[model samples]
Target: MISAPPPRPRDTTFGRSTPDAMQLSPDIPTVELTSLLGGGREAVILHNGERYRLRVTANDKLILTK
Candidate 1:
């Protein structure tokens, strides 16, 4: 009898995993926009100790400024 190999671990933090689709590398993480803004029009993000502002425009577009 032949033994099957162990299953590979998957990361679902980005969203649901598609069994038939190729998965992305775990090194890169993805986050939803709604989760970041929390139902608000603006959000502040800190990168390399610098502050950046992210806002939603009246046209429903996104703008990011440092």
Candidate 2:
């Protein structure tokens, strides 16, 4: 008796399993703290009617506080 051929691999070309879904946005918008704070070390960001403070710590790391 003849056996059946091996099954083909699943096609993921048109699915989110492709690498395209794992890539970052090509044109990501960014804000420079120096410009936003005008030579200061902190700035407030208003989003969706909420206030969030973005600051640089003494050790030079960023911190976001609500």
Q: Look at candidate 1 and tell me the lDDT of residue 43.
A: 98
Native-to-model Cα distance after best TM-score fit, residue 16 in candidate 1, in Å: 22
lDDT of 1 by residue, 1-66 (tens): 999999988764543345435466878777878999999999999999999999989987789999
Best by lDDT: 1
Query: CA lDDT of 9 in candidate 1?
Result: 88
lDDT by residue (tens digit), candidate 2, 1-66: 999999999855543644565456769765656888889999999999999998989987788999
Model 1 collision count: 0
lDDT of each: 0.83, 0.79
Please give the range of 10 consecutive residues that has the lowest summed lDDT in model 1: 13-22
TM-score on alpha carbons, each prediction: 0.55, 0.57
Q: How many clashes (backbone N, Cα, C below 3 Å) per candidate?
A: 0, 0
